[model samples]
Target chain A: MTEEPKPRRLTPKGRATRDRIIEAATELIARNGVAGTGIEDVRAAAGVSGSQLYHYFDSKQALIRAVITRQADSVLHPDQPRVTALDSFDALRAWADAAIERQRENGCRGDCTLGSLAGELSVSDEESRTDLATGFLRWKDLILDGLRAMRDRGGLRADADLDELALSLLTALQGGVLLSQTMLHVRPLEAAMNASLAYVHSFATTAGR
Target chain B: MTEEPKPRRLTPKGRATRDRIIEAATELIARNGVAGTGIEDVRAAAGVSGSQLYHYFDSKQALIRAVITRQADSVLHPDQPRVTALDSFDALRAWADAAIERQRENGCRGDCTLGSLAGELSVSDEESRTDLATGFLRWKDLILDGLRAMRDRGGLRADADLDELALSLLTALQGGVLLSQTMLHVRPLEAAMNASLAYVHSFATTAGR
Candidate 1:
């Protein structure tokens, strides 16, 4: 006879086991890649087994989506509160510096969590792609809000291309991460940030008019 | 008993088969990722069975290197003779414009042939990583040469940091492509190219001196 399914919501003990699986999955995914790391590997790393993993995730896709969603909340939302609070160029530059420093700590190998995930999976892998897309857009939205606030405060050009600048910042950040990782140095990251800061500030300065 | 290898240096037919396999594998790797793709998929796509696929490359890693090598040649050494041979601000902008056009045509979804492999594969995938690293350095060296030439000819700034500029240009291009692909649009790529072209040209102008 088919075993009855557990309740849609997990019991406390069941929840703990699921959390362990994802925790293990995160490290493995960061190193070995999402597709490269199998459920068995995740379960074993979490000190669980095949039965335990299947019970929690039901499928690999479910586990992947959960991992991405978890990363989204933890990473994309943590610094979000600061966006509204940033009203000056120094604050934005400081944020960039902090981002580069964190990436340096990671050996500049993996800055964009969503970017790493997107790299390993099919861009059309709808389940995972959606999560990555959401995370990126969320990041863009927050940064745009900060720029808009600055604009309102008369700290930015009224004609500043918010959307374009936001995208440029993202592209430069991603590019910097790649270059840093590839060269095993932070110089590229620094150069990109310096140039980007200059470019953005070029628009912010009223004297440029 | 081990069967005697039939002059396994790859006959023309075998070479053709090998090229087909590499081409198919590269496309699949770009779409599904190197980790997610398999020999079976490459063979099927190339219309060859498993044995035929194995006859050329001893392993998947070998095939990956070949693909990376191919992409390196395609990206850094396009068939059209040496537009980079000419050194002028207008020439640089024209080349940048052409590159942007290429991205626009593809909708910017495809990853850089060298870069996708580098970012997705592990650093410990030494053989392929080394192949990629060599390719990037070589391409950068070519760009560096071009910039140095421009400087010598008084087309660019005498004291311009050519290395930084070339690295930034490459990084920005990749980043711009990544953004365009994620959003399924062209505005990001256009802005990145435009800004980069402007930045580079500003440095190249005599007024900057």
Candidate 2:
């Protein structure tokens, strides 16, 4: 599932054009969904002609695939350098807080890029679904790695099922963000993250016990 | 947002025709999404002519609003007589189990009808967004009512914030189901529900403590 994205050896200028198109498609899809966003909308938004759009993407699905890849990278590594430091309970809370804060900052308008994509495309598009599943798996693994670090350092119970715990956090996040986006408030996101953090805290080696 | 659906004093036959249109729109929306499912598709699926479809639904948004109402009732009160009985932990777990079972039975294809709608329509459709928000609030209240029952029964600590707990469960459910739909598996659902349940159980007054 972690298969490398198809390589394209374009000149830097060509790469810039491709990125612009992907960026436009990402925004349009995020706002209007895959079904609502058309090839023409992306072309117009990206300021490219139809042939220019087709030059980079053979079809909307291909463009969506590129968008999925870009979203996976952005979502999983929002603060690329800090994502790996998510091992401690405080760090985890900060992560949740950061997510909630980001949502509030955006007035809870846009759902998580990957999550909304999954909601829209997962049902009808098989290839895009695979990319989304892979994105989620990568996300789960990031949380899992942090749990592993905590256990190694004796901050968590040695016997805790880290995989389940990691998945719980991710699930809470996805669910929380979706609800927040729908309700146009940050409360659901906050409540869900707090509960998942509490769940993770239950396995701590220290005071809460 | 909880405003009564528009009043239309149709005869039984007229009512049936309207219902047929709504049901067809619901299935089409559930399968292909609001933007993807056109009026033509619903008209054809319901075996109604374009004029008949238009007679019932002046516009696609009107039809979608009808679908939202129908989806809310069905999702919130799936086992209509039993939704209110969601008081005990046993009942709560049973509810989660039933949801997981249903997802498995469906091969984890269609997502929660209301959830997917929110995912697609919440960002752009203000009216539909309110309806979706109302649907989610009603769902949270059902869970909240259950937690209140548990606390009143002395099964939970008096200080436990039942509202937060209920939201946590709801969030886990949304996130879990979304992932399950995307990944085409049930583990995310199971893991999310289990963790939320465990979070709920953390407030239990006896035994584990």
Candidate 3:
């Protein structure tokens, strides 16, 4: 789902138009799903003529790929700086809180970006699936990095399988966010995160334990 | 999301036609999302005239409601006789195994029906969200029932919170199934289920544990 790199240079006006199209398409697709939002709707919403829209994005798929990248960036915002600094248990709890807070701020709607994309496109679209998977891996790698930090700092047990634990923690977060979005309640997300955190804490160093 | 109960009376041919429409719609929607699969597509797939399609379902949403019901039924199949009988840790493990086995048999492709529906329709369509939430609740209640059974049998600690545990387990399964389907691997699902199972076992009585 990767698009060709943008042109080497653009006028300020040209850059603004491209950003406008992506922002409009993102909101439209988020409100109406990928299938429900058509190129015409995007062109109208972005206020760009057909020729201009085609100049930036060759097809609807290319536009969607840009949206996915933008959404992924938004989803990973909470983990910035701290993702590389998550050496303590409390840091993990704070990370979870940030995720839950973001969902609550959005009224527990829209769901996760990568998750929504994966659910809609993963089964039918191979290229989109790969793109969504890449987004997930980026998130996963950040968490893995945190766990590795904990291990190096003697916060986690030496034998703990960081890869498996990291994936499990991510699974919990995804599941929790989904339930929270569906039920319009925060408890499910809290419970899922707590459960995963508890699992991570189980591998604490003897002194920490 | 629930239809006014189907007409109390129908001829054999009438019942057959309704069933055919539902089957075709379910397959089509499962392959292409609710928005992607048009009524005309269902009509063609089922070999029904436009009038026949309209006779059974007044609108696409109505047909989707029926498909949601059908998918809910499939998802709840494992909870039938076995849920009432799940009074031990081993029984819970068996339940997890069954879920994983089904996904494995499907090559981890389809993912969770209710989850997919919720992801696509929950935000944009309130009726469908309510329907999918109801389906999730039914599954949660069965797990709650089994946890209650274990509690009453002294298989669980007196202080165990069955409701939270049950929701957490369901959350884990939903997340696991989603990751497994996207990665085309079963480890994420297995890990999530294992973590939940371990939580359940943590409450087990001495001999039962």
Candidate 4:
């Protein structure tokens, strides 16, 4: 094996070009919206000639679809080994803190990938909807898995309904984010997160532990 | 003197036509989204010809703005008993029940004007954003006023931060609604609402008594 761990040499330059296209697309979409973000704008941002862009992604929709896939990584990015070690209250609190901090850095502005997906919900049919749906499902799964592990570790209510509760927790945070963005105050998010943690703790109470 | 309580001949026929135009527009905008809705489509649905549609609302944007105003009424409609009798826990429960039941009818389906507003936040400019902001401020006022009574009546945490909490509660519910609609199920809403009630009871500290 070469010193660089033998990178997959299947057109590394093409892969880099594709990434540039997506990075440009992400920035444009966030500011101008799915309706307003045009392919020409993305081309200019990527600093690539028109033909170079077409060489990477076939169309604007294709570029957006790729950008969306890239967004899924943000949803569960930085997932850690401690993910499975959530056998304590402090651990859960830390997880909530990490999540809140992630959104806080942006003050939740111009990051409308999720918003765009929602805005397009009724307008976009099968393929686009699936693209949005996949992002949500993955977010749900990651949290559900984390909660399930906590439940098995004797840190949760023996009868805690992890699935329903996880759904509630995520939804509350989402609404809280909207409020935070609108009011330009982060307290709504903090409040929602606290309430959710309380709910989880209520169910996580072992009969005598 | 004119007979008191005599309903003005306020274009009774024209009034009915005007109402129909708005009603159809509301449903379409909620389900199809603002940009996706067409004036011609609203006219066909309302059974009002082109000039008739224009007679009531100047344009599709005007009609959509009217639909948004109507949506506010749908939430605060029939106006509660000035205040839900805060003398007992049951009263708060009743209010919660009313809200949950209302949300359940469509389970957060169709035009959440606030969600619709936020959905378009990236691209919507000053005027339309102001229209949406006005509706939200009014909605929050209704809830804040209602919660304040609970505090005054000694039925809630006397020191409870009513405004912040109200904003949080509303935001959480909307978030839950968005999630429920996304999941194609209402469990998330039910859980979030239940947790809200529990929070309310905790504030009262007769604690679900």
Candidate 5:
């Protein structure tokens, strides 16, 4: 399906309508999955008129992409994290702790929105799969930036593979969260993050610490 | 939906029909998510008549559970591994290598079948979610058994927590495969498994090697 270009600018009212549609779609998809959630369901949940729903999202793919973007933003730029870069072990621990804490608070019912989308869309949808991959890369880059900062500061060993380290941590988080969601427990996520954090710590220069 | 109890005993012909249905459903779900694949698709793919499909699987959820079990068996008990227990570091590396090699061979098109099902059903279907969780636990147990053997053989430190190690490895795997499938690359899986293996290695006794 061809995805119509979303308008770059919108009136305040238009923006509100569009946000409502995305919010509803996100919730529905979270519960019922993308295939289970229909366009009519989104329109009904958003309470937007038929033409209004089409005005913002030309196709379901476009709406799903919007959801993916929103999920990436929420995950990558959470409000609690004042700093974007994880420059130190303490910062990294805090990042891991925050994730585990969130899962506990939520009772581990919902999986990561981005990860859930990836699991559902990656194999079946090429365009959506690329978007999911981009989201993962951006997430990996955020961690990479921190690893780079740590290396520059002499906190990490010079020989440590920063790219591998970043990818490993992201992988651990994604895997950990998925298990936690499925099992309705936080142990898997905690263990995965703890092990990954230990791996990063292994490369830490004691003098820098 | 009520699930009909699977008959305890089936004639060879009856078993073949059931297996055929499951095989078809597995392929369909692999290409399209659980929500996307329907009973009709499975029946058509299996070349079974309408009542024949129902005779085996009372509901879609029942069929999905069978798929989950089959995937778990295929993943956890592949034909290539002679020894199921990963007692040594080399064995662990080989296990990880086999998974990476499979992804490479497949060109990273299919996500792990059990994982894909988990991603789709873990949130929406309680019964299927439980089955998935059981499958993950069984997989984790295989790793745990290896870790326990390693500790007993004095290859791993006695102080090491085997549960955490096993969970971490499994988490890394699920996460790594998910990323590899989504990104259509093997690097993420490599990084994740490498880091996990290294973590396991950290506990190896000096004398064990």
Candidate 6:
């Protein structure tokens, strides 16, 4: 397992600079892809010196891994509590709606931040692939927690395969988001999430209802 | 609409050279993505002179378009008839199986060739995005044909929303395949296809059964 290099403690100003570098790299990569965006491009975009970049990240791969982490953080941070506290079908629907709304707000141009990176970086780099997979697993775990909560609350059938259901929902979201991004429409994402929710609903108990 | 450049009639040797260039570019782009793979790289990989490259393709965008067309063809060629002739539920299952087997054979490294390109190329290039959307529509249309056949044959309910179901299935597939590729496992794909088939099954009439 390749661990990310730990950064030394830095001044508050240095922390801001590091954050700027990451944000700039994320934008560049989100637009041009990992292989397409070079270190120079990131440097120019972030307005950081070469040494400054080195001060933060040891190498390009490390920076990319950090980007993946950052993207995952961005996705989870806003909805972390709601996502984990998904105790009802209504809560699940709300989460799905927010995702669709976010895509619409962005013109449905870019896919899930982690998904876009995964599609490009997964094939070539092992460390990056592992990081991405871990990132997805984190996302999955959150939804899984919600599903389990629903089960515990007598919302889902005892026989419901929560793990499979969770994975299916995530798969649906990834696929829906990809098509929506490519087609520049929200219909596909809406359809996918609907299907996934319906799948979960299939295992609903009377008590849950 | 931007039209593909018309090729002057080529001798057999010229045709082979053109094909060689396309194949090389496809491979390179598949590995490194569109923005990462340069004209010079394709030229070297294909062992063609700069003049030869320019003669065959007016620009790098032209070659990438050709590659997209080629990838679309590759996907449609083997299963085109079967996919369109999805006259039975068994046939639909067979199609799903074939897709999963193909992914397994490739070790789940490359996703739907066109899908991978769409994820990277869709944002930056309008022409490529349109071409890719067209390609996906073609794929969806084939599945739609199959579903319609089932409905007509009384296998599905008359009121079944074939278009929404088809789009949902395709979205499920894109998501499933994307996850499978990223995780290097076929489970996500399998789960997605299973859910899609089940969705179709839900609308099946007694006669269809």
Model 6 misplacement above 4 A: A35-41, A44-47, A78-81, A110-112, B6-16, B35-50, B78-81
Candidate achieving the largest TM-score: 5
Candidate 5: residue B9 lDDT (0-100): 94
Residues A1-209, candidate 4: write the lDDT tens digits.
Answer: 01111115548887787778888888876666666678999999999999988876777767767776777656655565443344466766776676567568876555555534555453333344466556667766777877787777777776888876676666666666655555555666677777776777777655414
Query: If the candidates were sorted by their DockQ against the true structure, best first, what order would they fall in?
Result: 5, 2, 3, 6, 1, 4
Q: By lDDT, who's the top model here?
A: 5
After superposing candidate 3, which stretches have Cα over 4 Å from the reference? A4-17, A44-49, A75-84, B2-7, B11-13, B78-86, B205-208
Question: How much DockQ does model 6 earn?
Answer: 0.54
Better of 1 and 6 by TM-score: 6
Put down candidate 5 lDDT per residue, A137-181, tens digits, no spaces.
Answer: 888898999999999989999999999999999888888888898
Query: Chain A structural similarity (TM-score) per candidate?
Result: 0.80, 0.91, 0.87, 0.80, 0.92, 0.92
lDDT at residue A151 of model 1 (Cα atoms): 82
Assign candidate 2 its CAPRI class.
Answer: medium
Candidate 4 residue spans exceeding 4 A from truth: A1-10, A54-56, A79-88, A98-108, A113-116, A122-126, A206-209, B1-15, B79-113
Q: Record all residue pairs in model 4 with backbone atoms less than 3 Å apart, i.e. clashing.
A: A157-A204
Q: What lDDT tens digits, residue by residue, belong to model 5 across residues B1-209?
A: 13535646999999999999998999888787777788999999999999999988888878888888887777555575733868889899888998899899999875546666777778777888888898899889988998998899899999998999999999888888888988889999999898888888998899766
- Model 1 chain B is weakest, by summed lDDT over 10 consecutive residues, at B1-10
Q: What C-alpha lDDT values do all the predictions have?
A: 0.68, 0.82, 0.78, 0.64, 0.84, 0.79
- Measured with C-alpha atoms, the lDDT of residue B133 in candidate 1 is 66
Ranking of candidates on lDDT, top first: 5, 2, 6, 3, 1, 4
B1-209: candidate 3 lDDT, tens digit per residue: 55633734878988888889988887876676676688999999999999988887899888888887777766456555544455578777887887789789988786437776776776677888788788788878878888898888788888988888888788888888877777777877887887777777777778557
Q: Estimate each model's TM-score.
A: 0.83, 0.91, 0.89, 0.80, 0.94, 0.89
Q: Tally clashes: model 6.
A: 2
True contacts kept of 1: 0.30
Superior by TM-score: candidate 5 or candidate 6 = 5
| lDDT of candidate 3 at residue A14, scale 0 to 100 | 93
